[model samples]
Target: MSEPALTKRGRPGYDQRAILEVAVAAFNEFGYDATSMGVLATRLGLSKSAIYHHFSSKEELLEQALDEALDGLEGVLLEQSAQVGPVIDRLAAVLRGAVEVLTSRLPYVTLLLRVRGNTDVERAALARRRAFDRSVSALVVEARDEGSLRGDIDPRIVTRLLFGMVNSIVEWYRPEGPEDAGQLASDVLAVALDGLRVSTRSTGLDRLDHR
Candidate 1:
């Protein structure tokens, strides 16, 4: 078997998905500061101009990848919130779908997590992330109103804790790991909503208003 050589220009040998996969891997291994279009092109077996044709800049690629993850979450929330169910049940379904996204689109979501307002693109991504968090927090508030979740903790604070734990899965999850994504989501929900014991929490918004 012979090794493949980098082809010169005109349409590039790789497709958008191929480029993104290589780019994301580079970003993951090298961090955003260290990765460059030249380096990414070299890694992907394409020329610089070829890569540029697909992406205006390295930051554009980063932004697009972040958008992919954000868009997935936005879609999940939009669809799940419309469904009829007990508030906690809806939450569990939302989380299960979120886990599916986190697993299926791990690279994109992983890149989303790594953004830290270092540049204009990163700042935009951070803003989008906050928007998503706010939306999720709204759901938590709704869940609280429905009396499906504990009311002692502030809803906004609890929302952050819930998402912090959900988002933490990217740190330890393996695509080929023994546990499936749905199972992981369920396990997470179990710990967050249920706990170690099997106490059946009921639904209704009977919480005394602290506001």
Candidate 2:
């Protein structure tokens, strides 16, 4: 038999998962709306028809990629460590789990972060993300109530700031870098739970009495 045909990119045998990886990368690099089926096909070195053989449309690809990120995050809440520990420990588990998810699924998480709710796929992803945030906020509140975390700041603000630090990793983190996910998670927890200073003496926030 003749040699198998190659795509324009000189590859053969594209599968759904491979197609999604490329699509998510393109979506993260260029906005989702701007990254179309044509763009994916071009990048994959395959024809649009070959792509459609795996997915009905670009929206399906987006939905699948978002699910990859959201499912991993939601699963973190279900872990035994996250479920049955002291609320402070549980919150730490969730935060560490979130970091693990982000680092392991960097491309998918990056795409999830960039979604703006412009399409139904994006809106659904946002809804799921908000639900995950709410769960983390609840953990924060419980930790404060148990006196493990400080009670001064609003739990909502604490949750936002905490995840803000976690999520910002998407901007500059590289899988090939020196720090592994576990180390990075430890660093995040140290900063969040302990603090930048050696001692815990209060200064600016205490003086402001913003509460």
Candidate with top lDDT is 2
Displacement of the residue 195 alpha carbon in candidate 2, Å = 1.3
The sequence of per-residue lDDT tens digits that candidate 1 reaches over residues 1-211 is 1233345534327767678778988998899889989899888777798889888899888888888898987778777453668877777777777887898888889888888899988898899888877867777888889988888999888877887888888898889889788778778878888777744455345557745
The C-alpha RMSD in Å for every predicted model, in order, reads 8.3, 7.1
Off by over 4 Å in 2: 1-11, 200-211
Scored by TM-score, the top model is: 2
Cα lDDT tens digits for candidate 2, 116-141: 89988889999999999999999999
Q: Each candidate: what lDDT?
A: 0.80, 0.89
Minimal lDDT window, size 10, model 1: 1-10
- Local lDDT at 74 for model 1: 75
